[model samples]
Target: MSSAAPVPGRFTFVLHSHLPWLAHHGRWPVGEEWLYQSWAASYLPVAEVLRTLAAEGRTDLLSLGITPVLAAQLDDPHCLSGMHHWLGNWQLRADEAAASGNVALGRHEHRLAAHALADFEQRWRHGGSPVWRELIDGGAIELLGGPLAHPFQPLLDPRLREYQLREGLADAQHRWGHTPAGIWAPECGFTPGMETGYAAAGVTHFMVDGPALRGDTTLGRPVWDSDVVAFGRDLHVSYRVWSPKSGYPGQGAYRDFHHYDHATGLKPSRVTGKNVAGPDKAPYDPELAAAAVRRDVADFVATVRQRLIDEHDRTGRPALVVAAFDTELFGHWWHEGPQWLEQVLRELPKAGITVGTLEGARADGYVGEPVELADSSWGSGKDWRVWAGDQVQDLVTLNAEVVQLALDTLDKLPRGGERDRAADQLLREAVLTVSSDWAFMVSKDSAAGYARDRAHQHAHAVREIAAALGTGSVAKARELAAGWCLADGLFPALDARRLRRCRDEHTSTVPTGHTSAVPS
Candidate 1:
């Protein structure tokens, strides 16, 4: 080790990037538009920031988790063409706004659209794999991955959970040629003994909520005597920028996410006040937002500095503070987020606050004593309620039923024969049915109808294909499965033959834990 003095604490940012499979889905209010918006507003700019920083010799800037489902879309031939068209449409909309006399909004959007188009053409034309590969191979960031469809691990059937986790890791390996050791567990939802499953899948580390650690998030903690560690997000520092009630994005100078100019399809107003109506919002001023970004960056650096000193003083040891957020928060939900991120990454080091990735934190000994973790998530109430609550009980039940049928049908399929397209599609539909997003959206009432519709459609596909296979109508089953695969064909790597109900792999035998009403 170098003879340099240890800093008070280290800080790392974890950005979870994910979206349910949306290829060939409907376009507006909830479907492919979600993918295109995030790709344009978040992925394009975020990749640019990392690329710029990496060119300047930066490494280990942050840990980014791109769920397997989302990765598949980003690289899919269909989605790439869709994104390209989306960019072109964006420029056209800007031109329309200008011709219609909304000059300021038009000028702003035109510049952004032009830049995004250039970036897409230059770096992303082939697919997201190359874009992500450059960052991973260059050591610019640590890529964290999760299950095939971001299922809620706690409620997922053990066999399905194991299959998804293992397949998810393999998906990452296939995409980037490096299997991630860490995962941003879907919903940050976890149950006890999952560490055993994680270990079996070669995952060395994963993330949970702050309260899961009983609020002692000084470092990563090993779970249940295993080498696998769980890192709890330090909510004190994390919430300062991500809290739903108040965060940097909520500042009045920032652009308002809810208000949009219908003609040009652009957000042209600043958050004038917390309770102000959309029409009352003031026109957005980039200069003012830039100032706010600078102020917030300084404030964040100061926050991290104070946190480091306070932690060091309290523990008599250097500390680690992990601030995790959704990657889409940058430039997507918060228009100024990418700028804020760039400034914060640059300012933290200048302020003598160490910035590193989660992988680096683990290797640098930012770990704590072993602790028995429980059922928890970084969601409403910091428990499983967001995914398994009363509002989503139907979805919860549906997921269980679909998973069982898919597993049973796959198990009964003959071994070592031509690949059964029906079986693969059944598993695919089953996995899609259990995606945490459906339940989350339902529970939160964000497009609950859409969530329910999606859940049921997938479940129906599972039931249809399973029935056809059960009745010895092999051709009929394949036909049904082929029809479903037209829409949900993201993971070509998923072969039903590779799946089995292995029950003895996980070493930890602790019973599943219960959830509390603790708020995250």
Candidate 2:
């Protein structure tokens, strides 16, 4: 075979790993189960893939974003125990399916479940910090962090935004001994002038959607004259793997993510045909799916190659192609996803394409001219509608009211003696209330009831604690705050005292005409 010429640009795959705080929350349909499933199906395998690559001496392979709230859950004692149990149960369930005569499905699941169980027992028992830190230390991946609780920063109070981001960076340092210079901004949400806040927080780079850069995504751009850079996701490249209309995961040969064997709690069917009903779909054939993964891997490699060549021809320089997605989209949502990811990574180099992390991209000079980026998100309409839409008006109002109350109450409380559990818990509830997941779920109608209930629960906690303090029921306030802490405890480094009025507050305002406010 002839040796192919080198590809003209670099490629970065970013995976944003996040889930709303779910400890002590209900299970089954939507709660701790969400966490456990993603942990087993996505995190375990994905990290293993990275470890395998690192052993081969690969470095700067990708950018991995783990939000503070998710990190907290991963390292939480309660979550660790729960995950252990979940892995064992998964193995047991697979065995049950085998005993019930679905031999193929049973064997498939059993092998997977057993591997997951052993992986969890040996590597993950201590918690996620060490698992992730290993990758960071190996220089296999760059860790990206976001604000506490993954709140939608654009809709949040400026002071609260600043506080959350600072504490988030500190939390990363506390966990992995390194503060990330880049972030996968929650929801990729941004309002104008947020870059200045990012600069103040010492962030050097962040990601946004393709449209946020007006389709010019060949390189990272400095935002509004700040030293901070904004890397725009290349939709053309990203959508090849997963998009609204078509994607590799939807291929008929791949396992059906939605079709489940209820008794075994395992998916048993393949896509077979898009119109095929669950029961009518063919049984999942690993061999067939593996073949599809190979085909799709070739397709994606070719797609990236052409895109890079086209970009180089246009820009007269080596370009950057970024394809980012939620980490859970791997084994959790697409059974063949991990397989596809591994093959793609291995094949890219042989195919003459270069792979590197976002940090490496910036450091290697893959940056472009400065631009004044406006309000944008990777959400619906490429704006903040998913978080601040009319459909979530009540939630928007609720977040506003609760956050103001929490701030005012914290402001009145004494500052800087020690970490006040009551004040910390109050702020925790407030932060949880504004998580972008709640509104996104509500807008997408994925789990609207659960989303609304969670938002209200956190809002209620904030109100009760503040009211107790106002009524001089100091004991009552502590009790209420302590109770909420049982569930909303994630960021231990958060200091409510620091959230008090700042003499020079970092406002997120960016002058007139730049307001990308959600439609009223």
Candidate 3:
């Protein structure tokens, strides 16, 4: 469209933003603090960046995946109040740090805290749904949604998978008055027949890791006659910005995410050098960090331009490159990441490179011919081993049992009356139990114990409520369900009754082909 022949056809930046249910859960070790930290450090600042761009009339190319569970938390009244209070506490902490002689760090945090507080009080007082809705409606960000609870869908029961996917889409519609045609499939995970389910739910496009296509990830291609396109992440580009061992974040000039000032609960040092002890680290100079952002931003932009040019020449057409990453990586993990994003977005267009949303690419007729995709995920080996391997076998079994019990309990419920709160609560706990986070945490040993306990607690809730019902004590079951709902309440949109059992399976909209897999 730009008449520049070698300009990369399109680049879509997909950011998946999610957190396990943590609102009414504990505070310190693995609970509300996790939520609040990401909120203050990531979501608020990221949203502010996007909103500013939107106000300046730049509305294209950014795709954000806010999982339904995450959406539930953002919209919940409890989380809104908690986030407000948390911001106030953040400012107070910064003030205390300032008085305690960490003046530079104190002033820096105090500014961030004050800005976050003002932003929250003025714009976010109602709830985050409205903020996200504005972005979606304004076309500043393309909204990518997923299952109600973000189940590792490939391993989930097919019927519940459909139920979760459909309900998840419906939840988006309920919030913003429009159903998203594109979804960020949880974990970028795919099982062969699952595309039919996506088509059935009206999803027109989704993402997967690059290796899912045997590393030929230059374009969005249809999977086996289904018009729904599957876009693969260009890991060469994504990992250049964020990989475990090395990336822009690990650069010496950036803020050190691990170094904490225990006295003030603040990070006060830059990444002085690789693996250097926290105490030996030098003070964080904002000027140095700012310079790193500029250098990284320029380097990343050049990387994209060259990547697109290479594909354009090889394929004789404008190529599409999707660089996907977690939304938390921006302001939370990388500190200057959001600033880097802002700069890259602003600079790409000026560089004569085409940048637009995945849908924009489709509308521009940029989709290539269909390709056969193997079962894959964005994990270590581009396989499902992370969620269903020896390391997490116990979690795998726990998830299967919880899901089966939930389906059985919901099926046995009497149909068509007032809402069945007990059965609804049972389903909520079951889905939460199967969140891919637990298995991932266990696999990575990030917080295995806490992940196991959370999964088991929710699974136990499902069993207790189901047992009470089976014992012919409806009153007792209701009481038990009410108690669980008090803590596990997030998706008010879920109905156990919506669980779909396949009716003959074949669909004209979705053409079923065959299954494929790669070894761990």
Best by TM-score: 2
Candidates 1 and 2, the one with greater TM-score: 2
Best of the two (2, 3) by lDDT: 2
Per-candidate TM-scores read: 0.96, 0.97, 0.95
Worst 10 residues of 1 by lDDT: 503-512
Clashing pairs in 3: none
**Which 10 successive residues of model 3 have the least lDDT summed?**
506-515
lDDT of candidate 2 over 1-520, digit per residue (tens): 5536898889999999999999898897999999999999999999999999999999988999999999999999999999999988988899899899999989999999989999998999999999999999999999999898898888788888888999999999999999999999999988877999999999999999999999999999999979899999999999999998889899999999998899988898999998899999999999999989999999999999999999999999999999999999999898889988998898888888999999999999999999888899999889878887889989988888888788778777765677777888898899999898999999999989999999999999999999998888889999998888877777877778778746147443312353455665
- Per-residue lDDT for 1-520 in model 3, tens only? 2433337577889999999998887888789889989988999989988998999999885989998888888888998899999899889989999999989999999999999999999888888889999999899988888898888888887777787888888999998777988999888888777787888889999988898877767878898768889988887888889976778999999999999988778999999999799999999989999999999988988888888888889999888888999999999999998899888888888777777888887788878889877678988777887887789889878887777777766666666677777888888898889899999998899878888989999999999999987777789988998999889877786777665334224221211232234333
Cα deviation at 92, candidate 3, in Å, is 1.2
Q: Backbone clash tally for model 3?
A: 0
What RMSD value applies to candidate 1?
A: 3.0
Give the higher-lDDT candidate: 1 or 3: 1
TM-score of predicted structure 2: 0.97
Q: Model 3, which residues run further than 4 Å from truth?
A: 1-8, 500-520
